[model samples]
Target: MTGPRFTALAQSLPATVPFVGPEAQERAAHRPFAARLGANENGFGPSPKAIAAMAAAAGEAWKYGDPENHDLRAALAAEHGCRPENIIVGEGIDGLLGYLVRLTVEPGDRVVTSEGAYPTFNFHVAGYGGTLVKVPYRGDHEDPEALLAKAAEVAPKLLYIANPDNPMGSHHPGAAMAEMVARVPEGTLLILDEAYVELAPAGTAAPVDPDDPRVIRMRTFSKAHGLAGARVGYAIGAAPLIAAFDKVRNHFGMSRISQAGALAALGDKTWAAYMHRLVAASRDSLAEIARANGLTALPSATNFVAIDCGADGAFARRVLTELTAAGIFVRMPGVAPLDRCIRVSCGPEAELAAFAAALPGALARARQG
Candidate 1:
């Protein structure tokens, strides 16, 4: 019997998984990590309120989640001072990214992003047969001007920028981001991914009219909110831009319990503030850990710090391998200069202690070989 044939685009694509998850790694290693700090997930865990809400709603999991996502959207709209029409909730920012790429990209269409920015976005763009035009980072930060220039040059269908960017954890001021937004070409759409916004310092997130049609800003409960496993995220944009998501998005994609949990999480601002403090403290502690090991941790506004291993990508990879072998789970950037650094996420004392204990040995082992 003959096997099924893939579409032309699928046949043309390489079989690549953008991220190798921790579960897969554990399966291969035959052991659990002593410290799991990679992937920028908030290790402090979710609020008591959110946990309680989810537990209460778990019994009703047999029913499909609300297709409209009405209750959660309304609560989110009220929190952000926008109409429900301005919001589109999804499984997570990753899923929302896929939907956005599908909505705007045609086969061979152009998309622009930072060279070493979020790989998930790039993966989705590639899946849709969009040509990715990448701009290298300037000074370890996503250069807004360069990105804008490339967008204009390519007249890309979509441009992706992650404020408080991942892997590096650097960010531009809100005013600077607004300036870039103003300069975006008329036909292009900007995807401002603010997954780490809750951890950013004040004024780091640019102020924009939530109704702005030129860009859609995505926020997730994954990072600062400690709800990564819930897979809840939302996009804010002009009503029309947000409404378009409904045309192709999986209406019943959101888990009902996740909605309840996220709503409770949003309402408990005090708990959010507490986690913010914990993250800030963990960041400092991780920085100190890096410094103690003679490594330099880059200044960060997110839950992760990019520590310079004072060498090239190969050396950094060696350090990462040793660390992982020592049961410390962390990640590094994928591109050249940035890849010289290893990224570590902020977590509770116990996890940080494990990383701290493992670092010197990891460095020593890497240096020996």
Candidate 2:
């Protein structure tokens, strides 16, 4: 039998996997991590209500989830004080990003983002053959002005910004974000990824008219909601832009059980509040741990912390490798300056204690090597 012919795009693209998960690392290490902190997942788990909802929905897995995500959109609309037409739910921010790129980017279309921002977003842009234009962070924070200038210069179709940014854990106020949005060129669409927004301090999220045509804000249930496995996320924008998602998105991509779980998670405000407190406490504990080792922890508004290793990227890389070998899975930034720090997720006492216990040995070994 003849093999199927590949599209030119598929044939031209390199075979690459974006992330090697902790389970893969464990397989290579021949042991499970004592503390899982690499991926910024909320170790606090989901609300009891959400778990119960999923359990109840499990029996109904034979049925398909609502293609339009009507009920979930309705609940979200009420919660956010926006009409349901302004929302488009997808598998997660990652999936939404792919759709957004597909909608806006033809091959060679320019997309602007910070040099070391979320790799998943970059991955999507690459998958669609979008040309990436990266601006460097201005002292640990994504430089809004620099991004805007680049957008103006390149006239890129999409501009990606993650407020309460990943890797560095720095953020800008909502007013600043609003100002940045106002300055975006008419044809350029701003993709404000707020995956960690719910975990940020007050005023960190910019306020924008839901009907604004220049921007689309994407959010997820993965971080503070502890529903990473649910693969539920939504994008908020003008009705027209939101409606455009239907043109190409997988109508029934969401699982029935995940939809039920996400709906429950949204309604459980108490659990969300509790998770916020736990995150704050964990941040403080992680800061203390870093100080004890003579490293400085960057201030974080998300469910993780990035600790400056008081050294270069090589030293940080050594520390990260040693940490993994010590059964503490953690990650680091991908580029220079920022790459001098390691990122660790916030978790419960047991997990934090394990990280703390293992740090000194890891550091010593890294130093000796």
Candidate 3:
């Protein structure tokens, strides 16, 4: 007898994933990494209050989380100066992106994104059989003008951009972003993934009208708030678009403990400054580490730096392999010329030191080969 038939979409899809977690690497290597710098996770970790809040919620996990995401959305609404109806919380931006693609994209629909932007967004678009039209990065940044031009021509179902973009850590100013918002083509929705915006400097987040239906901006507790494991992220958009997610989202998908943790983390305003300082210090630390090794680290507005290895993608690959062999888990870009650099995350002093020690050897070995 034949097994259950797979849908054509499922049958045609490849099995590869966007990211391989460090734990998977640890298992393959048979040893834990001396430093985990890949995946852009916050090595500094969650707020103390969030941890305590999660601990307190552990006993109540038998009950399901609030389906409406009431408390977390209220907190996020206040933080963004919008009403609760303006926000929708989900299991991080990744989950929200999936729901978004399902809500808007369909087979053969055009989706526009910058080449070498966040891969996961592309992954979601692909999963829905949407056609992706990628615009090349103008220099190292996502060129908003090029993206909007492409959108105007393609009139895509969605346009995806990550501020303080991943893999490169470059960001456009708020004014530039606002200008892009003003030019979105009719019937196109701009999905601004601000996963790292909280880690960016002042004026980084574009001040778009929350009631504007053409844009949907998302932020995650996963980054600066250090709640990646808690999987909390919220989107801000027009009320009608925000309500559209209700038809597609997993009503009880968010964990009860994660909700409590995220709410507590949101209330702890002091941690933002502390984490900001830690990230700034660590960025400098990575920069010095790169300079000492005779490399240059790109300017970054987020909690990571992309170090130019001063060679081709092959040389960068060797450097990454050597670093992993040395038990320092780091990642590089998947495509060039971005692949000519390896991305490093901001970590505490100890983890950063481990990377620093391992890097020179990795560089030397990469040079020899």
Clashing pairs in 2: 174-206
Off by over 4 Å in 2: none
Model 3, 1-369: lDDT tens per residue? Answer: 999999999899999998899999999999999998887889999899999999999999999999999988988888999989999999999999999999999999999999888888999999999999999998789989899999989999999998989989999887788888899998999998889998888999989988999899999998898888889888999999999999999999999999999999999889878999999999999999999999999999898999999998999999999999999989998888899999999998888999999999999999999
TM-score of each model, in listed order = 0.99, 0.99, 0.99
Over all chains combined, what TM-score does candidate 1 have?
0.99
Q: What is the per-residue lDDT of model 1 for residues 74-153, given as tens digits with 9 covering 90 to 100?
A: 99899888899999999999999999999999898999999999999999999999999999999899999999999989
- Residue 184, candidate 1: Cα error in Å is 0.4
Model 1: worst 10 consecutive residues (lDDT sum)? 203-212
Query: Clash number for model 3?
Result: 0
Prediction 3 global C-alpha lDDT: 0.92
Q: Across residues 246-287, which tens digit of lDDT does each residue of candidate 2 receive?
A: 999999999999999999999999999999999999999999
